[model samples]
Target: MSSDFYTTSILPFAGIIIKICRAYTDSQEDFEDYYQEVCLQIWRSREQFRGDSKWSTWIYRLSLNICLTLIKKKKNNRQHVVSEYQFVEDTEENQAFEDESLNQLYDAIKQLSEIDRAVILLYLEEKPNKDIAEIIGTTPNNIAVRVNRIKERLKKILDGKIN
Candidate 1:
């Protein structure tokens, strides 16, 4: 991608890329890899964007998909390691959640299924159900129900009522 395009189109949405990548990765190395891969994919796939949805919405969907795909590939290659409840330290590159409760909530969110993780992340961003449903490829009503169920599950996870 051209520097102009990267600066104008992609850099502005780096936080969205960071958040999705951070949720899917276990360590700083993996997070950086995922972040770079998402940006690369977004740049490579720029032509595929047809303006059907807002740019941020398209970025969210693409970032989520790239993370999921990378994680799956790692798993299939037997390169994936599952660590229990390890929080990555904040770095200058990604000044991620510093609040203790936010960290705890993110830890809980990490325990969710991949789709649930994506749904909750988008929901937390305050995206409307219609927008979330469009990104997630489901009906708005399904998004509504799923959001409620995911919220309850997150609460249970955070409360230590469920693992």
Candidate 2:
């Protein structure tokens, strides 16, 4: 991957990428692998962006898809990185959500189904339900219903009613 493209194209929108990777990964190693693969994939496929959605939206969808693929591959006993990336040390912006409450919230989010994780992440990002539905390939009503159920599920998890 060209460093210029990464510095210009991918670096500006890395927060969303990092969040998606963090949501799906459990450890620093896996997080690094997933984060690297996501950056590589985005860098590799940058030309495919045809302006259908905002750049951030494309990054989110691509990041989620890559993470899910890596997860499935890991479940099947095959773990690999598509490409090795030279990582920059995380700046304070990337480390902004290190609070205990946020960690607990992320733990609860991990307990959700993969699709639900995507839904909740996007919802939390404050994307309207309609855009979320479009990205996740579901009806807006389905997104609304699922969002409500997911909130309740999260509440239950946090309250120790469900694990």
Candidate 3:
């Protein structure tokens, strides 16, 4: 991503990107990778922003698409070799919320389908059902039903009845 674009477009919304990446990834390493890819994707897809919705909403959509695609790619390429001389520029920005409930919630979320994860994250972010539907490419009624199902699944996972 271009430095100018990164500062102007991405820095302001870095927290949202971090939160979405946290929901999808298991490690700081994966988080960093997703963050960079999402940044690059946002720069590439900036032209698609027609301003129909808020800028943050567009970033959320892009982050979800890129992270999910990366997940698919990693799943498909299990035989890849490790790179030599890997350098990790560790920073204090990789924050794990210090609440057990939040941790457990994230763990349960990981058990959801890719789209379910996105829906739940937006729901947890307290986004309205209509907005969730719009972001996830579904109807508001569909988002409502799916939210209920996701709640049930999360309850099951929380109660130790399901893995």
Candidate 4:
């Protein structure tokens, strides 16, 4: 990638990468490591982007694929611990919840299945269902239904109702 292209296009996505890593990891160390790897992946794949989808959608898809692939590999190796991303706090501005609540929410999101967490992150980013579906390789209607279920599950988590 050209330096300017990377600076303008890829550099802007650092925070999004961090958020995705946080949603998928638990510890600060792992978060930093995964974030770096995701950046490397994005940079390596930048040339392949053809503007087919929104940049954010493409990045989200890429990050989710990386995390899930790692998860599956780990599982196969009998190392199925929750990722270090399981315990992140929400410190982003314009976030609707307080720190404690946001931490709880992140905790809840981390507990979701990989696909479910991707759906919720899309929802949190205010991406429409159609776009989310496109990013996640699912139908729009299916994404909508999944989003509803995710919301209910989130409510259960926040309300201390998960059993």
Of the candidates shown, which would achieve the greatest TM-score relative to the real structure?
1
Model 1, 61-160: lDDT tens digits are 9999999999889988884557887555666444346676777787788999999999999988899999999999999999999999999888887786
32-146 per-residue lDDT for model 2 (tens digits): 9999999999988999999999888899899999999999989999655565674646554444266857877887899999999999999999999888987898999999999
**In model 3, which regions exceed 4 Å deviation?**
2-4, 80-95, 161-163
Clashes of each: 0, 0, 0, 7
* Model 4 misplacement above 4 A: 1-6, 77-98, 161-163
lDDT of 4 by residue, 46-88 (tens): 8798999889888888888887776677568875569877654
TM per model?
0.86, 0.84, 0.83, 0.80
Q: Which residue pairs collide in model 1, if any? A: none
What is the lDDT ranking, best to worst?
2, 1, 3, 4
How well is each residue in 3-112 modelled by candidate 3, as lDDT tens digits? 99999999999988887898899777898899989988899889989999999889888898888999999899878667887554443344366665777788789899
Displacement of the residue 58 alpha carbon in candidate 4, Å: 1.2
Q: By lDDT, is 2 or 4 better? A: 2
Ranking by TM-score: 1, 2, 3, 4
lDDT at 128, model 2: 91
